[model samples]
Target: MCPVTVFEQDGCDLRVEWGLDGVHALGPHCAVLVVVDVLVFTTTVDVALGRGARVLPLPWRDERAAAMAEALGAVLTPPGLDESYGQPGWTLRPSSLTDLPAGTLLGIASPNGATLAAAAAETGTAVLAGCLRNASAVAAAASAIAEDRPVGVIAAGERWRPERTLRPSIEDYLGAGAIAAAVTGRSAPSSEATLAAVSYRAVRDRIPALLGGSISGRELIAAGVPEDVALATDVDVSTVVPVLDNGVFTS
Candidate 1:
């Protein structure tokens, strides 16, 4: 379990940590859980939710996921970085999800963000998916749900090497920071949260360019999907907030 430092913010408590493991560690005290994956997953969720689609976040890629999707009458997304979801009403890229039919259901499998989201569902706290596009909305929704209860923001960082080790993702950090800052207002942020919030403020104006030049951004661009980067960096462009309940995300 990761060590959690509590912060008094907005006359309430708040906790921020990295990755799924951190979610497991601090989730119980977390009345509101915000999971951020700015590269694609959370961004896609934002877009899908904006279009009024119910998105089910599944952890890991396996044959079982297809069955779940079929049962939910939702389109299933493959767990690769490719731009396609191979379904009629779904796509992995956030920009593509904008045109989805309203009330559509989409089951998406992501290696990092979805995994943390799935795990966070078991904590009984309100679960929210956040990205650059909907950071303010997420913070508002989470704050409303949490009220005076503690809130936890989890940055679903990616692995660095072939082994499994959480490498701090700059985009996720900034996204989390933005949310944290928005949520806390003038509250005293913890050291880690402070760093993230400060980092986000520094590049608040250059979000699109910063994300485009990021490592994951470059990887996505190399994969022939630069539009995803643009969509993900459309800061505060969306007001729809996705809240997770019963294994699915809905606005």
Candidate 2:
């Protein structure tokens, strides 16, 4: 009865949904979108853009990845940090993008957020890469860009194991909530966005601890990327807002 995906067409002014399906259903409802992937992808984009680099987000890694980078004249993230291609100067990690020269176009690939970004463009809305680092700024920017257009905020959730179904990522939900709170302010938010905002406030005081112990956070720590988690949960530490334009994101 829900039409598989339904936009809760009622009160509030924003749509806060999750993953590709979220985009598919809610994208057209607004002309400005904020895509949040605090765990990594968008976080990397935020840092890169904060340093003045342009970013092109790719949905998934595949054969055309290298070709796309070359075509876009963007720097490719090395296949691995310790492998032969892991050049001393170039990287894909959010922490390492600071070394990239200003004015560079960085084409980044990720399994979730990046892909959702690409999909968001199809909605013909202005899309922005958002995270905890720039929540208030991104929300303010989105409010300005939206003007009269409705806004859609997509929390690009991580995959559930086994079937790899889209699972709500706590970090992403919190990130989305941060933006939602900023955007709504005294205004009422949709139920979804309200849920997100409440979730964020509940764990806001302990972001690092909450994320550090989350399933996704644990996986990143186990994989030796605790730094990424730290950088992402630093809350309001940045003002850079990565807005997607012409298939690229720039601050």
Candidate 3:
């Protein structure tokens, strides 16, 4: 009834939505989007820039991704970090809002969420990453940006799979609510965002259980990353905004 449209597609509905094929066909067309890969998105961005690497985002066949980065003076790297670190060329890195301050521009190379960020960046609007960790801060920043300019929020999900069914990232969705709360100044989020927020909030005590259920969580524990998830789950530490520039991710 709000006249706003929300698109939902997955698994059994993949065929109806055209699944992976649909993303390639429809993803590029979005004017603005904020791909919120929350857990890894902001964390990876923070780590890459904190390490002092120039990050450039390359999205498979999306020519515009590289073109935009190049246009902004960013260097191109191998498809993924594996190939990039094996060679040389500024050593492309990853970044997010938590790594830089407001007003700094960055060219991102997200292995998984490049298309969403690319679409948003294409619109001449300020593109900022959002996460539950920085949800309120990001929303405030986005609201300020939107007051005088257009802004879009994109939730970066796992890899696009046509035939395979994937569940939406609960963390990212909760982060989105935080963003919406900041943007709209409403006591509650839109129905969809509210559900996401409630879901994640409800699982507060079950983080360990939830982690055990996740592929990445199991991998991290198995690899003995030592507090990797705990570090990622830190609710508040610094309110830095990571920005990408010339293939470098800086705060």
Q: Quick one: ranking by lDDT, best first? A: 1, 2, 3
Task: Compute each candidate's TM-score over C-alphas.
Answer: 0.89, 0.89, 0.60
After aligning candidate 3 to the native by TM-score, how far in Å is the CA of 154 from where it should be? 2.6
Residues 102-202, candidate 3: write the lDDT tens digits. 33334545454444444444444345555555556666655554453323455555543454344455455544544554464333233444554555566
- Output the better candidate (1/3) by lDDT: 1
2 against 3, candidate with superior TM-score: 2
Query: What tens digits encode model 1's per-residue C-alpha lDDT throughout 1-251?
Result: 33444422232356678897778766776688899999888999888887878898887766688888899898786564553633443566776676888988889887788889989988777899999889998998887887767778899988776685888888898899899878843354456777787789988999888888999889878877788899888889889798897899988
The segments of candidate 3 whose C-alpha lies over 4 angstroms from its true place after superposition are 1-33, 49-54, 61-108, 148-152, 160-167, 181-184, 187-189, 204-209, 223-228, 243-251
Query: TM-score of predicted model 3?
Result: 0.60
Task: Please give, for residues 154-243, the per-residue lDDT of candidate 2 as tens digits.
Answer: 999888666868888888988999898788433546789888887887878998899899887887788676787889888999999888
The per-residue C-alpha lDDT of model 3 at residue 240 equals 49
Specify the poorest-scoring 10-residue window by lDDT in model 2: 79-88
